[model samples]
Target: MDTYRTGDEGRAAQETSFRAHIAIAKRYGKPLVIHDRDAHADVLRVLDDEGAPDTVVLHCFSGDADFAAECVRRGHLLSFAGTVTFANAVALRDAARVTPIKQMLVETDAPYLTPMPFRGRPNASYLIPLTVRHLAEATGADLDELCAAISATGDRVFGPW
Candidate 1:
């Protein structure tokens, strides 16, 4: 779930909806994939208030090392996207370093946040390797091991394919 700094009324409604979505995910026993843009504190606050789902994925996680550590502590998997491959994402790289391999995942955030060297181009799952390769380097993780761990995380989050 995501929300901007809309008016007070709008923010209230969005938070209500976010809470409902969390409830639904819990009821169905599915992972809640969050699209937190800049509302890290509000997202964490609401989740804490409503109780997060069993499996929560911080989709395209954009938080810094501190927030990443908090999420990891709460057992929420951090799924890095192409943004992590950007040259300016030093904090993101630090976040990845703190996140355990078992708690890390990867994504393309398709049609957006394309990895470097092709940043202006449209993104797709096919470009995931570029992001994955960058992530491996940034986190100082073996490429093969990172890939394997990400695959396992996929199964853990969404069940076997």
Candidate 2:
């Protein structure tokens, strides 16, 4: 489609879109939930140039340890999903280990990225425990403690319900 074009037109529009979103979030004092797949560098660049909101959550973070560290340094939150528990997610696990517990949050990303046992099928909110448990194990943090941290951080990022 139009977004799939390789020329400068689409690229400019994409950049403009990001800038506008960032600007609106900044002006309104709203937290940003970033969905960055393989565009970690581009997303970070935009955030850096446009100035990120006070709180930025990298939803379903897919970067390496170094990128994770950078996000932490920049004071952004990193939310991990079921992919961190995948057999081939060594890099993702590594990132989780190094990310401070206070700066991390667990998510199910329901209807997608189902945890190991439930893979190849649709995921639901009830499956969050599976992801949270994996995150605790990977981070070497006590299960209860990790759960508490995730809960607290999520509340702060999205506001308490």
The best candidate by lDDT is: 1
lDDT of 2 by residue, 1-161 (tens): 12234465566777788789889888999988887766778888889898898999998888899999999999889999888879999999999988999999877787899998888798788988988889888888999998888889888878885
Instruction: Give the per-residue lDDT digits (tens) of candidate 1, residues 1-161.
Output: 45555656677778888899999999999899888878799999999999999999999999999999999999999999899988899999999999999999988888999998899899999999998899889889999999999999999788888
Q: In model 2, what lDDT does residue 56 have?
A: 90
Candidate 2: which stretches are off by over 4 Å? Answer: 1-9
18, model 2: CA deviation in Å?
Answer: 1.2
RMSD of each: 1.4, 2.6
- How much is 154 displaced in model 1, in angstroms? 0.3
What lDDT would each prediction earn against the true structure? 0.90, 0.85
lDDT of 1 at 86: 85
- Cα error, candidate 2, residue 8 (Å): 6.9
Clashing pairs in 1: none
**TM-score of every prediction relative to native:** 0.94, 0.92
